[model samples]
Target chain A: MLHMLEKTIADNPLITAFAFVGVVIWVSNQIGRHLTGGRVAGSAIAVLGGLALAYWGGAVTGKAKGLADIATFSGLALMGGAMMRDFTIVATASEVHVDEAKKAGWLGVIALLLGTVLPFIIGVLVAWSFGYTDPIALTTIGAGAVTYIVGPVTGAAIGASSDVMALSIATGVVKAIMVMVFTPVFARFMGLSTPQSAMVFGGLAGTVSGVSAGLAATDRKLVPYGALVATFHTGLGCLLGPSVLYLAVKAITW
Target chain B: MVIFGTALLAACYLAGIWVGEAIAVLIGVKANVGGVGIAMIFLIAAQHFLKTKGLFPADTEKGVTFWAMMYIPVVVAMAATQNVVVAIKGGPIALLSAVGSFLLCFGVVALINRSMQRHASPEEADASAALASAPDALKSR
Candidate 1:
């Protein structure tokens, strides 16, 4: 059974990742609902789903690769935790004075602009350092995901956990649409292979999901849960890393 | 990595808000205040809807539904795009940017709330005092 399971995952990384993510999501939702007696459990489920995916994915994929992948996964897990901390601090803070609403609105606008621009600039720089061609497209996709998913998740989480179900559904749907619509455009823009493009986009989705979950969490207690979700997602990606790598190599070689 | 998308999403939301605001202005709609009034209306509507549905008390499914809807597009995008490497590399930058923007908005709002509290009118203060004293008075009686 173990051999068969390994073979199945080896042959179908995408399917495995999808199945793993789905299962985690469902289980987390059920557990969260049971515990909180509210829908905030969905968010908790998202967090747990991400973590479980990462852990299982990592364990499966890291078997022959030694500890490097494990270390990377661990690092990502830490970062995920850190991201949650920042979100918690900001969420717990009191709302601005009523008189400052206008100021806040203006500031929000400014923040929005900066949020869009700064990441692109940084991504471009990073890509350039790595000698990657046409970093702009990658940057755009990355920044766009954050703007769309992360902000709302954080806003919803901090302000109201009730928003989680709606946000999750909306995000999932939008992301699916964007992936179908934008991937080809991005592929042409970046002149990247399909696999490369897919990996980049998938990574973007995972990151946004993780960060959004972190930002949306109200209680400090939930940070670990959120981090665990991210870790799981990352692990799943890593576990399937070899298959993805094989596909990329084949595409490049061909 | 998907954090990058936050910018685009924010742009979309802002665009939606702008359109809403423009329509209101074009129609010559008047309110006690401008943006806040609009936002307050939305907030109240959301709160009322939740309360009416009994989802605000011990029920949170409605809110969860809202989040799930938002995530649908996101998940679709993920599924469509097969690339995971670029996302992993770029995820942190995108997340940080989004968080920064959110904090700026949140902090500004908090400051506004504080200012409003500080600038309360004497009449408003007296009215609040009366309201607070009334409950105690009733208890004493």
Candidate 2:
């Protein structure tokens, strides 16, 4: 019977993958709500948990794809693939209404630009400080500081190495976790009280999950407002990171 | 009808990937650049077009919501796809870049708020004060 169970799970990889992930999310959510009292977003905890599992999988199998390298979890390869990842991002964007987005006005625009460039500059400086003088590496790492999606996207476009690209993603994930944990703590202090302020905050923060989760915890009403501007950071960062920023870094570092 | 929304998502995704690939090739890059971001823009534009055409009823929206519900799972799945251990062990570069950028960004936010406070009119300040008391009012849907 145990052999049959393993065979069944191994044969239906996608099904097993969904079930496994669902359980992980459920447990993560419980932990977020109970353990951290919702200060830390459940999603952040889940991501950290996923990273740990991936590290464990690497240690266990001495191979990549994290836990999916294990036979029963192999469906994770498909479930976690680019297809599902992009599909989820598209769906999240569908929630934004054009009219609601228009409320951000010029302030949000400035915040968005400042948010993207500020992070990139800081990221580049840090990368430089860490002795990453290669223009591609600096830009990629800096872009990753903009957002995780943007980081990997920029790194891939600029022909960064696998190591640098992975660091870019990790850096972005760390930024997301930072936004998640800090938004509520600084909400009132930062004057994140109005829809417009939420929009500006989102623009400054520049991570959909981070801004949305932070705002949701701070004020469920502000989720859409903050998320609206934060959503654009992905495209804006992607557009700017590998092109303008890359050139700027090369010129300065050259 | 809801399935149609799912199909729309898939359609936008494929289109986004196509455009992303095209952009990558144009830029002499060997990989997709903004596929995910472009796909998002496509979804938003396509959905808006459908709504303007009165074709995107609430039922179709449900299909989109189904994928939305799977968000947490997919995010975990996506995060799992990357190998963080290898990245972090590469050095302190990743952690430092993230933390440094984050601190600066947070400080900028605080500075922006302070600047805005100085520039705010009395009525605007009163509005912010009122907003602080009643957050639910911000839900301008």
Cα RMSD of all models vs. native, in order, equals 19.5, 3.4
Task: Give candidate 2's TM-score.
Answer: 0.87
Off by over 4 Å in 2: A133-136, A156-163, A216-221, A242-254, B122-141
TM-score of each: 0.30, 0.87
Q: Please state the error at residue B59 of candidate 2 in Å.
A: 2.1
lDDT accuracy of residue A200 in candidate 1? 23
Candidates' chain A TM-scores: 0.28, 0.87
lDDT of 2 by residue, A36-108 (tens): 8876677777877777777787678877567778888888778877567657766777766665555566787
Give one clash count per candidate, in the order shown.
Answer: 108, 0
Which ten-residue region of model 1 chain B has the weakest summed lDDT?
Answer: B132-141
Relative to the real complex, the DockQ score for model 2 comes to 0.48
Tens digit per residue, CA lDDT, model 1, A1-254: 99887766566654554454455467656765576443243543454344234434435554321111343233222223312222221211111122222222332333334333333333334333444343223333222333333322222222312122122223232332333333233333332222212212222333333333322332222222222222222222211111222133224434
For candidate 2, lDDT tens digit of each residue in B10-94?
A: 8988898788789868976655656666777788889889899999999988888778667668767756656655765855777
